[model samples]
Target chain A: MDHRQEDQFEYQLKSALHRQEPPNGFTVRVLARLEPARPEPWPQPWLHLPSLRWALACALGIAVFAGGWMFQQERRRAEGEAARQQVMLALRITGAKMQLAEARVRHLSER
Target chain B: MKRTLLSVSIVVAAAICAPAQTIKVPESWDKLAAKADDVVNVSLDKKMLQFASKFMEEDENEKHLVSKLNGIYVHSLEFKNEGEFTESDVDPIRTQLQGPEWIHIVDVHNKTERENVVIYLKMVNNQSLGMAILVEEPKELTFVHLDGPISPGDLSDLSGSFGIPKNLHVSEKETSKPKAEIKK
Candidate 1:
């Protein structure tokens, strides 16, 4: 095409794509679209009460402590019983040997 | 400095003054244990006796005797064959009882049956400190040491209750028999 025709086409394109004012509330609409909607926090009404929270924590602590104490007590009792059996056996042996010694003396003296 | 010195002196004195109650078993005895068919070893110190006494509910006499004892040690070995151990194995135990404080209370040897039983009592100022019994049979050897203030009379009462031979129930009269040989 000739230079005159090219210049006419360029003027038409510029007028057609000229900058203009944005529609009203365009910024607010874009911001709202980009931003995330915040959800509500989990409902913990019991945790919000200080006394109930403290009570639950204390009960858990006490259960753990009492279980440990009972285990220790049972262990000690078992050990004590074993030791008792040994003591009895020792005494029984001593007594039996003493009896034999005494019997020997008695038998010899009768002769 | 003076307080520390006093404390040290008191501890040293207590250590020296404490009666030697526990009999030292010879390490050589371990060799016999390896050959034995059955072994019975019981070693209970003062703390163990105290702990065990709490559970001695079956018999009051046992509870009383156990409470008074500081320690009890027994080592018995049974052999499958005759003469698995010799007199030399027992000499170490006998030597320990030969200390000045220990008095040989009973020594009965049956030559015919090849059985020997010896009893020794540790006495200090007429107070019984402890007792030791050594019994040797054809296939078994038993050694018993009872620490604390216990006399033969205390053990005599224990018979017939704790699986001890019922015949061991010696009355005071029988225990005092002239032939029974009660050494003061």
Candidate 2:
């Protein structure tokens, strides 16, 4: 009984594990049964690409530097103009004082 | 590119139009004023001067003298005791201002009173461009630099509003005293 039962078990196992040719059109049938998988949207665009990331960072740096330089130049020009105007104004105020003084002297002479 | 270049050109043109000469005042004027017991520093640049003129009532007979002004910087530092600022401190300004661009119009020095008054006129092609007055006393140092075309008569017209008219109409008696004394 033990030898017969063991032989039967071995045969069943062999049969289960044995390689066999699939039926004709098996792949086609399986593929037809399978649903088409939906593609997920890209989480990150060009920034996720290692090559483009450095380019993006460099472009940003250049833009900020250029903006800062332009601003500095404009500020310098404005400051120079302001200083010049102030000088001229100082002279005018001086003129007014002198004129007032001369008028006083003239008025006295007339009296 | 064209627009940016155009804008830049406009800025350059503006810079050229008002080639502001460096108005000489002590760079330390603000600091000195801070150290004094009393300080009166009045700075009216071109824009401020223009804005101030708007408040003045329109006069058809007036020549709008204020429009001619570029700026007015007046700094008066009054100390508790004398010698808060040494003569060395002002000598640089005096020296720099002694060139042909300037003419010393009035020099009144009374050593007994320890007072000095000197007025400088900036002459360009026989026309006065501006004026600077440096007044020094034992306890006070006052400097006023007015830039632009200034006529005393034009100033007299605006005197009542500016507290300058009273100083302008000084009689012979007050004129005999130090003009600086009557100025305040």
Candidate 3:
């Protein structure tokens, strides 16, 4: 009813509304359950068998040698064919020119 | 003995007689080149000239006028000699015909006779405005220029008489703009 009593009542109501309950042993429960994680075991060393290494090396060598040989063979074959073609072409050209020259000469002689 | 000796001498003489002269065969292109100097210049080939003239004489109204189309010109050709014709032989004519007003679009090589066949097309926009071909054969030379809406496919059709090389490519214009014209 009085100003002081009304002020006290309002303060008490605000305090009651804002008050919070204490947590139920949450920190203790979490600490009790917690345990440090174990570090994973190191991976096993890669297999390095002598036979496997040798087999791999042999395969690579064989592949390289085969590729190189094939390339060389192809190049030589191409060159040989080109040379043969050139010779044939030249012979053909020369023969035609001679024939033409002969015709021209014959015509000139007749005139 | 004297008779036998005479017979032997005659046989030997006959055997020593020179073999008949073998006429060497020349290749088709080589035979063609040997007569190049006598071949008519590209400016004089009657058939090609007629075709070019016909193209130019088309009615202006009937002509397909694309903003990208340009002028057309043609040349008659004959080659009459066997020497290797260089790019220089064709350069003078190309220079005269090509300028700010004209563009160079194609250069094709005829391998059989080692001849350079040059084609110049006039350009407007990015399209072929006109077209021309300079075919230097072993025994003939022909130049053709066409002015109109010419397509690159039309050139493929025109190249039937002469063998077109597989490596033929259309030269690109220097400018990035579509309106840029290609120069020789």
Candidate 4:
């Protein structure tokens, strides 16, 4: 609140914020701390064999082809089954209507 | 000369590959369908019939019939109330069947009950080429068109092989409302 106290506060503030020499290897230590941790990659020695690479590729292709073929077969089967059901239903409905018509005709003939 | 030959071949191919007959439902029928509570519309082309034939293991007759069919179209609509559709709405299909190719087989109309059943057969050179059946009740309408060589005698086989369920009596069909299982 007084000039003396103000001067003392300014002096303390300057002392606390004044630049000072950093400890040895401060930059080196910070840089090392900032560096990210990385795990060693897994060994891929098989990847280097051309024949093995080709074989693996072929196996994948075969698997994909087989899966697609199986899916197509299943789709055809489902479609066939559905078509069969529709045919049967249509036939049944047609049959029922015809029967009714026949009975009516028979009744009329009797009359 | 090559172009002429190509055109001739194309025409021949079309004639050979085309179905015996086809049915066209009137556009107004679509309006009725919108008000229907349940509708059954099944259409199968030649390829589909062939595909279905493969699965008709239960019935040899079915397999034979399906293999010969070029197409089958069945449309049945059940309305929530009576008078959803009128006789005039069915006139277009009936008129179409009145052509020289189609012969009117059975026509039974009960004016009191407002029920009508009309059957037609498409004949080419005295051989039946197709069959069409139209059934109209107070609250329901059904039309079936089979495009292929199907004779009148075949009708009896159809009635017996896949006979109507015993519960689906003709008398009850007028009053009772039982949805066909396929409608589900």
lDDT of 1 by residue, B1-184 (tens): 0000012222232245452447877876788888877777777777677778999887787888888888787777877899888888899888888777787667788987778988777777667788788999998888999989886677656667644555544343432332334321
Which of candidates 1 and 4 reaches a greater lDDT? Answer: 1
Per-residue CA lDDT of model 4 for A1-111, tens digit only, reads: 999999999999999999998999999888887676545555568777999889989999999999999999998887677677777777877877877777666656677
Q: Which model scores highest in DockQ?
A: 1
**RMSD (CA, Å), each prediction:** 13.2, 14.3, 29.9, 12.5
Stretches > 4 Å off in candidate 3: A1-111, B1-73, B83-89, B100-103, B109-112, B154-184
TM-scores for all candidates: the values are 0.70, 0.48, 0.29, 0.68
Error of 2 at B119 (Å): 1.4
lDDT of 4 by residue, B37-106 (tens): 7777667778778877998898787798889988888778888799899878899998888777776666
Distance from true location, Cα of A78 in model 1, Å: 0.9
Model 2, position B139, has a per-residue lDDT of 81
* Interface Cα RMSD of candidate 2: 8.9
- DockQ of each candidate relative to the true complex: 0.30, 0.06, 0.00, 0.25
Candidate achieving the largest lDDT: 1
Tens-place lDDT per residue, model 3, A1-111, is 999999999999999899685699987777777645545555423426777777878999999999999999887555444333322222222223223323333444466
Each model: TM-score of chain B? 0.77, 0.70, 0.41, 0.75
Where model 1 places Cα greater than 4 Å from the true spot, the runs are A1-50, B1-21, B163-184
Clashing pairs in 4: none
Candidate 1 C-alpha error for residue B5, in Å: 48
- By summed lDDT, which 10 consecutive residues of candidate 2 chain B come out lowest? B1-10
